[model samples]
Target: MTRFDAATADGRRELFADAIRAHDERDSAFLTIEAAGNGANAGNDAGSGSESTPWVQFADGTLNLDCTDDELDRLKSLLDEFPSFTVDDLTTPEDVDGTNVRVVARTDDERVGEFVDRVFQRVYNRPDGYRAWVTVV
Candidate 1:
């Protein structure tokens, strides 16, 4: 299993998306993904929280890829394709215990779960080991 270090917002999103795709494709049950908040930038206040000063927060998740080698490769490939998708308002190098990678997402839409699910299904198909924080939006 490849060790994924999602220290940044973009990296986190990519990692999360990849894990979801891997779960959908291989039907792996051991691997579990969950949204995790380490309080990296939780209450840093970005202006007045208005349109111009949209408060940025860390939306985090973890992917436990305990699957076979094939599954791991598939997950990696999915992550590599994340740049194809458009992700805005994200910060880089989300520090978690002094590690960094880049993981974040804009949560303005109520259908975030649906959107994530759709992205997973559109790219792969298995439906497991992928979760996100709905309140981020």
Candidate 2:
């Protein structure tokens, strides 16, 4: 399982932002979060369609979210802090959104390597890691 290393929603969000920002070259960026909310379930059931996936498309500077402006504003505010961490050695995730959010980093305009490639490589080669995925009905 791509471990929920972070405990709370904000923690996860911070982790996500950190992942994107660490590779972020420009000051501005777009954030994308793939989420499947369970209708009125209150997280009582543990299956599909009850998780959220967020991504920061630094290349395009856009945030993929299915929420309101208020939500976006809050996220933007959080990003303004801009925390940093190491993604190269994450416990290796089984997937990104459903498997792994592949993050590639370029050097001087040339593709050097994936920033968070380890997450996939470790699992891709060994096929054993932690990842949480729930398909919405």
Candidate 3:
């Protein structure tokens, strides 16, 4: 996990910006994060279509998406739709396989959690190193 202080906005911006830039040069990139707490149902019942449980807490830091070309494109689409995120392409050329975009977080931590939960879901009792294993739902 690339260490970025998720507690601060500047850190998040730098992390996202750097990730976007790094994605330009590499075939894959993943932000690694440490586990912070137990994954518990946050009052949202099963089949509700909305999960209250957070796979990676703010305190748990952030994990890398380990994105592929297609996944990065899909992520860009998701970021475009998400109000709290922006796909910045001013500094970089268009991505070869995807759009050259930087997914910057424009909102607070709580909202970031909500956005991530939309893409990655947590499985209880499954640990990946110090973190609970997360999968696309």
Task: For each candidate in the order shown, give its overall lDDT on alpha carbons.
Answer: 0.33, 0.30, 0.38
Candidate 2 C-alpha lDDT tens digits along 1-137: 13323323444444454545443543334433222223343223323354443322334332222223343344334333333321221122344222222222333211111222222222222122222121210
Query: Cα RMSD (Å) per model?
Result: 17.1, 15.0, 12.7
TM-score per candidate, chains pooled: 0.26, 0.27, 0.34
Model 2 alpha-carbon drift over 4 Å, by segment = 1-7, 25-32, 39-58, 65-137
Q: Evaluated with lDDT, which candidate comes out highest?
A: 3
Error of 1 at 136 (Å): 23
If ranked by TM-score, best first, what sequence of candidates would result? Answer: 3, 2, 1
User: Could you tell me the TM-score of candidate 3?
Assistant: 0.34
Candidate 3, poorest ten consecutive residues by summed lDDT = 128-137
The segments of candidate 1 whose C-alpha lies over 4 angstroms from its true place after superposition are: 34-137
lDDT of 3 by residue, 60-130 (tens): 22333333356465665666667666644323335533223334566654566545544342322222222
Tens digits of per-residue lDDT, candidate 1, 1-137, equal 24332333444456545554454466554333333222333223222233221111223432111223343344346545554323332222344222112223333222233334333333323233322221221
Q: How accurate is candidate 1 locally (lDDT)?
A: 0.33
